[model samples]
Target: MAQLALDDYPDRYHLSNELHARPFPELTAPCRAAHLAIKQPRDAADRDRGRDFAHLVALLDRHGAPRPAPGANHYSGPLGRGFLKWEMHTEFVTYTIFADGVSQRPFSGEVFSLFPADWLAEAPGLVVTSCLVRVEVAGPDLEDRLGREVLSWFVPESLAVSQVVDAEAVVAADFRIDENGHCRVAVFARPGIGARRLGRIVQRMLEIETYKSMALLTLPTSRGVAQAVARLDGELSGVVAAMAEGGGQENKTLDQLLRMSAEIAQLSTASAFRFGAAGAYEAIVTQRIEVLREERIGGRQLLGEFMTRRFDPAMRTCRSARERLEELSSRAERAANLLRTRVDVENQAQNTEVLRQMSARAAMQLRLQETVEGLSVVAIGYYAVSLGTYLLGPVVEPVGIDKAHLSGLLVLPTLLGVWLMVRRVRARLDHGATH
Candidate 1:
């Protein structure tokens, strides 16, 4: 199994895709040209040029842009949502435009005027807002003309001396412009814009994205759980129907039917339990989704407030659904346990009745055996007495004794012996049975 370390997760980047359609080619060009101009030192003797160069380097470092290599004239960093580092030099600015992991192209264009030191002195705190503006002009070469026109906003005086650059060039200029032009200019940054503030802005943007993705995951899970619950409910109905349609009330068949019914009941109970679990899960997911939605919306609002400075409406909704779901889960558990207990009690009662019936039948069989034994003794005693009587008749005839009176005497003794033997056997059997 491949394991992903926590540190290996990629940082999410959030940039609106629609912003790409705007004329970014007209925006980054002049910034690159200004960056180059500061490095080349047009006046090596001038202390101001050196100072401007140092300031430009500081700005680039603050923005996390790469420094030019030793004896190298230019450098570039990943730009526009792929690391997002835009370069501003004396001559021109170059920044890469990216969409879906692939770079559309590198946009490079020339700068018209460098921001003077006085401008920084006037506005101590400034924020950079890069806006991609779109325009249309009538001509076969309309796009090229529009690019030039947009670039002119940075350097209105240099249009006559400028060279026609590539069609897909990026122009970099400050948001500030002289009021004497048709194009609107905005200042990109003021003197006091610091790294810490930029980091906070980036963090807020990331938070917004995180909450949005969490919402997406949660809502779907809730829907899936709800669907599962519905399916289980249908299954439970079928189990109930099966149990109802089977045989009734004949003990042997009823026992089998009841067992089957119990099994179906167990299944139904299981389904109900699952349904409740799924419902609870769904409720949890819904609550999470709602919370995430609120977070996403709030984070976005905060980001907007940070960027534009405004208040957003407060979002507050109670989670009654979640509470209801928990209650439902508890109820389902109780219901299932109750059903199980009832089934167990019924099965135990049935078993007890079966044992009772067996015991009664065995007792009756023992009584019948005792009765048969007593009758056997009576029959045996009568036959023995008759044999004695016949034998005595012959013997007494030789002695001149009455045979009939001798037979009567033998019958009394035989009957008494049979009665005593039967009584003893019955008593023994009764004692054994009691033990």
Candidate 2:
């Protein structure tokens, strides 16, 4: 028997392996991590991505780390005292550097020094989010030391501390920028926990911070749009009020409405991508927090609670701004439609008046036509009677009848006959026209 032929899809393998593209690093406890997220300008969707690749190559070259494959979106390898993982996202790139051991001092601002100053200075984009995370072994008196030493690292009021991943690790962060312009996160993991578990914990914490900051980037845009929309609302209200007052200026009102609608459309178009991105990033932050399944540590507020109190209101504001924009757009469209309807109605009224005038003129013309027809009938009858009188004058005299008397008798009948004939002819023409 012949073997059956098979067809292969070109991207089958590549697509299937996409989920594993960025596997969580294997991290033992007692490690220091620094995460940096860099982004280009908002309007630079088509900016030169090669700059990111070039910068990554420079860093790799300095540390003699293995070069990433060409056209790769992510890479992970060793760099001197740490292993660096770099991932290029749609709007930004993140580099996570992790060293195997913590410094002698906790949260001393030394962990982030792993990045070469010269290399960072030459970065291609601006830093949007930077975090210093320190993972250490949990000591016997971890709870007691937290208030005295750990809690002091962050603002006491705003600090969020929790035990996550079934109490595999305790995480603490204040979500504040220090003097060095970096956020700090601390994780204390049980010594017996597997390295992969620790890695996952650290990854989740860093992601929460990065995504949170990214989500807030749209706040300013939302505020600006809100102010612009408010002005348009007032203008639109004035236009609608004018229309209600029955101003004979429908054309002007329509023009104003069209301009308002166009401006709203432009605003929506400009902010569509940013708004959508913000929503997506916010969702990711929530998902990351949920997966952590945090429990309170020593009656302290959990990270989720902190986000609810501090971060959720900002997201709500962004949402409200978007809703307001949509509402204004809808109102503008409705107003324009109303104005068009009013214009159409006014035109109809004018047309009705014109038709009434035309009807009056038609009635006058019919009356004049009737008078002209009567005169024509009379003239024709007179001519007919004269002709009859001349032809029958001799015959009438033989019968003892005067020609004048005969002509007078024939005039009445002639007039009646002519009138009837004219009426019949006109009637036939009218009937034909109707058909």
Candidate 3:
């Protein structure tokens, strides 16, 4: 087994290693962390990721830390007395720095100041969300003071407090941005909690904040989509009403309906990615909180309950907007198809009338042709008799007959011969035409 010789897929080892990547930091209590998620306002998903990587390197250079290999999407290393972790995501990048101890003024400017002002200003994109968090060692004597601190540091009305992970720690946050321009989160770990366990709790809190912010980004988009859907719905209904009324504007109504359908399709396409990303992020927020196994603290709201009252409605709105857009698209398509069928039937009736007129014209032309042929035979027979009188007069002079008598006698035979000649020509023409 030590040296088995077998072919392996090129990505096998790389994929296996990825599972161990982005490990939770081994953080003890009495730690301070600052996290930032940055994204380009426009086209973040298809951004030039190299710029994100370069920005990360600039910060790593400031700390004199070893750089990640080229094209790497994740890195963890030292920064001053803290550890700096960077991860690149599909639409954003995150930077989290964890230090050994809390600042004198915890959850304040001190933690966020870890990133130099100039460096932050030069970041590749705008900050989607940023936060400061403090993790402290729990003490039996400080329980009362800690409770008071939570009420004072966070907005009482929106605060979420819970004992999590079998009560190994307690977590609290108001989920609101403070004057310092960062959301604040606090954690207290009971005695004997391992570094890894403490790290996991802190990570979960930041994950919840990061993903929740991302998920809410879709709310405003959903509102805009809703408005568009409403306008399109009304216009489509008007077009449908026109179709029902039959104002001889089927072509016009059909054009309008098709345009509405195209607009709805465009709206759906534009909003698809944001809605999908929101749902995914929302699920992540829920899952991260679930793993903590939270129980309410001091009758304060748990994170799940808070989300149910606030966040869930926004997600539902987004879903409703998407569904309405789809429904409107279907309705427009159906209307357009119906109008087209009606127009086709009307056109088919018009074509039938035209064919009837053409058949009548052909019958009239055939009768006219027969009349002309009969007149032509009579004219030819009269000329043939005049010519025969001249020729037969010379022969009849010897039999006691003149030109006038010859003409009268030749008329019957001349007309009969002329009729035979006309019939023969008509037969040849008809046969040739059929072949």
Candidate 4:
């Protein structure tokens, strides 16, 4: 028979001897058995040769002498370095049993079963490590019997099961069963927004991801988110009311109430993330929505009060400035209208009268100036004639003339010339004024 190799077996059939040794009460007694001892090879070349063919002959010698079987069914094959081969009737069990003096860890006692006859038909000349077991009986009860024997190896003592629920229905659950069949069950807890019991319930629900996510699914109109924020706002309002009712006194009780209100506000804001999956953006949106709702409500409530206080100083300044400006403008306008009316009606008549009086004064002043100019011309002419006669005295004396009598004759002709010049100047001035 051809020797079998270790790698030729499938993963399920690698059960060690410790797993097969598990006592099963279901198996019948007095079954035929064959054993083959395995040894690790010292030399590298012979290691590939598998188990010694002589070992199989020896096991046959100990059990029952070798019979002249004509087919390959009577021979045992080889497994790898740490394994041994054994055949019992039509059944084959492989064991790893090298005494190489090295310490080894025990297998975990997990076993898997397979049909080798079917596998061998698929792959000829294949040496597989799987055991080929043939039972004498077959029925529907076989699977149950095998299952019972398999599960008896290792079983746990306890189990736990949990379920998560939302407003709609159950969302998720995890089951853990034990050998004793006892289960510890847990379910998600949800809290109402304004209920007195809500705080503790919310704290518990915050520990669970599914419950937190469910709590945050409010409509867009801020009704649900608003209610949540209002709960905190109401607590703050109560504190304010207490202080107001106490006549603005700083009461320690009211201060504590305010502090608690602030803490609840912070918690309510932080808890928005509990309504959705961890790290989900919806959780953040819900938190922002809650904040905005609070701002809107408080803003509308305080709108009038804020405006009233804010405009008081500016309003007073504006009113005073406006009144003063209006009085000044009214006085200025009246003065301007009075001046305009006077100028429009009587200004030309006053100007004409003043012009007529100035003309009469100017005419008298002109006549007086003419008379004075006439006298000045006569005096200048007389002086000039007298000076001429005096200059002629020297020349006329050489001709035996009288100088005084010639000056007197010259003075009359000078006076007549002066009078004519003065009259001409007066006529020019009068003609200019008429034009």
Candidate 5:
């Protein structure tokens, strides 16, 4: 059989590989996992990503493990007896360690000691969140009461306990930072629960903690943005009200409006990525809890209920702040447009008045010019008549006619001819100007 000749796209393999990357760790029960997420405080998404890769490589070297490919965003392999999973995200990077046995102290923060102190001091960024997950398989002692021992491990006030995956496991977490500065989550699974299902549950628990922490990072930003939005809103309202008066100084008012609009746009652009990223993380948090199909344990609250009471408001604040910024930006844009139109109309009115005044001045000047032309014709005609009478006095005497009467007859004819000639010249000049 002959295969058809075809050309592959430049990124076909890379794109296909992306779909299968970052697979969940396969783990059996009675295990311990330590998860760490690190992010830069400023411009994290634009920071030098090579430093992150270098840090991962350094860790692999310390453990005598193979390194991930250059430019790869994820890696999973053995780090001594424990396994390591590393992933890079848009603004942060995460590392998770899975070991075979649970700690005797049950999340006493020993897992974190796996990373050398000097190596952690060289981390590329600050710790956004770190968690200790302890997975235990149900035994004769815990078969009927998986939550009994965990309930005592966490603080009772903020604790959340749930049965997930059709009651195959019981998960409990107070979602509180312990003295060791790590969030603690516990999972107690049934004996018959497959390794894959337990792995999935453990993955969900880590994601919820990490993403929840990431989502709340926007709350402080939202508070600052809220204040700015309020001030801009007030200023915009005043500018719009001033525009309604429709008077002079439109250009100055418009300048003020434009400045306000520019500020609004700036605020929107500055906070856009953070707010959007937080919103996405919040959705992931919700989805993870939903897929767990969480059911309450005894009179205790479910994970979903705990999130609703404590976490939902912070996320909503992020959303509300973003919404307000967008609304304020739109309002400023509308006001600027209206002010510009008003300025145009005002300028047009002023121009129309100027044109009207110019037209009136032109009409008055034309009348004055016509009066001066009539006076010039009279003066020229009088002079011409006087000269004719003086020169022809003797010639007319022989015919019995007086010089005074001759001058009288010449007066009207001279004036009429001069006026007609002046009219003809003025008509020619006016025709030239019209063209």
Candidate 6:
């Protein structure tokens, strides 16, 4: 029988297909784009997943936009005269709205007007980052255009402008919000630049912004928990100090330490995801900047350099907070162990005292039992002698013997016999007990 190569691994098809998912949108030059990332409250992970799907459907239905298949993670298609792309990620969803041409006034709020105001208000999540991108054909005046018009609108110190993709395009952004509370990116591409290349450039920019925003989400978390972490550390230090002092309410101290440990553990569990997600997102932000392989434009700082100076510090703060949490947790654990050891030693001492008392009582009971046993023998001998005297009287009277003398002689023998018998019974009892 012909055997097929071992049946493909159950997820082989799905796993391989994932790489092709969310392919970059094909775009033409002279396009104005609006990108938005929306995130629910921190508790969104537990919210109904259907809500996201429903929201996507509502937007698609509005413009007669083609519906994505059920359980689709991404979609790109026509929205009126332009195109729209939607992608769902682990923590949030992204929407990119593309138009055919650049707005006359750069970074105008008009691009966002494409999404009906009512529809936006009904979004399940609030906007985390919204950016207006101005894409135009490249010309010899690229540097002049930026120095004359764009540079004035952005902060001189923070602006990052770079030429990328073999210098076919120059991209610049200040990473700062404008008067309308939206960031702006200007992309000037040479005429012959392929649509796919332009699309890749745009995609990278959006990703940089999205992941950067997500990474920053952990910053507030870090700050909020900073004081609590410090307090716990101080308390833990006190506990350890008291432990070192070698006395004074070790149990109480242990209780306090354990309580603090519990709190720290709970905090760690609560923030674990945010910290981990931040680390991942930060890495992505760094990678996205690297892949751009940027070169300086007109002595402007490269994107990589800008992020190093400006964005890197924020990420470092997040790292520091996470490290502090870990250190505090470890300290709490060590303190708890020391306190438990103290409690165990104290308990052992108490048990030893209890045993000593038990031994003393047992000895006393043994002495009292011996005295009772001696009295029992004497009583038994006395009863035996009285009976013997009565029986011997008749025999003595017949022979004219002295009954009193016989009784006296019998008393010693009776006492000896009763004592011997009592000892034998006690010996047997002791032997049985030993067995």
lDDT of 5: 0.89
Q: Please, what is the whole-model Cα lDDT of each candidate in the order they appear?
A: 0.38, 0.90, 0.89, 0.36, 0.89, 0.85
Instruction: Give per-residue CA lDDT, model 6, range 54-95, as digits (tens).
Output: 888898898898898998878888887678898888888888
Poorest 10 consecutive residues of model 2 by lDDT? Answer: 105-114
Clashes of each: 39, 0, 0, 6, 0, 0
Q: Which stretch of 10 consecutive residues in model 4 shows the poorest summed lDDT?
A: 166-175
Q: Please write out the lDDT profile of model 1 over residues 1-435, one tens digit for every residue.
A: 876655533432223532442222222211221211112212222233334434445544654666654432233443322233233322223222222211122122112122334533432122222222221112345335435644555553322111111111111222232343212211121123333332222222222322222222233333444454455445444444543454332244334444544544544453443343434433443343232222121112222322122111111001222233344444444444544565667789999999999999999998998788778877988897888888778887777678678877788789888888888977998899999
Candidate 5, 426: how far from true, in Å?
2.4
lDDT score, candidate 2: 0.90
**Where is model 4 more than 4 Å wrong at Cα?**
1-343, 398-401, 421-435
Ranked candidates, highest TM-score first: 6, 5, 3, 2, 1, 4
- Better lDDT candidate (3, 5): 5
User: TM-score: which is higher, 2 or 5?
Assistant: 5
Q: Cα RMSD for candidate 4?
A: 36.1
TM-score attained by model 1: 0.38
lDDT (C-alpha) at residue 28 in model 4: 24
Candidate with better lDDT, 2 vs 5? 2
Best-fitting candidate, scored by lDDT: 2
* Candidate 5 or 1, higher TM-score: 5
lDDT of 2 by residue, 353-383 (tens): 9999999999999999999999999999999
**TM-scores of all predicted structures:** 0.38, 0.84, 0.91, 0.20, 0.92, 0.93
Candidate 2 residue 163 Cα shift, in angstroms, is: 0.7
Q: Give the per-residue lDDT digits (tens) of candidate 3, residues 127-182.
A: 88898888898888555855686678889899888899999998888889988789
lDDT of 5 by residue, 1-435 (tens): 986699888999889989889777888888999999999999999999999999999999998999998998899998877899999999999999999888788888777766879999999999999999998876767635545666677898898888899989989888898888899998888888888889899999999999999999999999999999999989988887887876677899989988888888888889999999998999999999999998776778899999999999999898999999999888888888987888788789999999999999999999999899989998999998999899888889999889999999899999999999999999999899999
245 Cα displacement, candidate 3 (Å): 0.7
- In the order shown, the candidates' Cα RMSDs to the true structure are 20.8, 3.8, 2.5, 36.1, 2.4, 2.4
Question: On residues 1-435, what C-alpha lDDT tens digit does candidate 4 reach at each position?
Answer: 877665555545534643553221122211111112122312211343323333344434433544323322223333222222232221122222211111221111111111123432432122212111111122345335333532242231221111112221011111122243211111122222222222222212222222122222222213433444455445545545654465533435435554554554454444333222222423443343232221122112221222234323333333333333334334334433543454444667778989999999999998998788977987889887988798888888877778887787778887887778777887898899899
Q: lDDT for model 4, on a 0 to 1 scale?
A: 0.36
Structural RMSD, model 2: 3.8
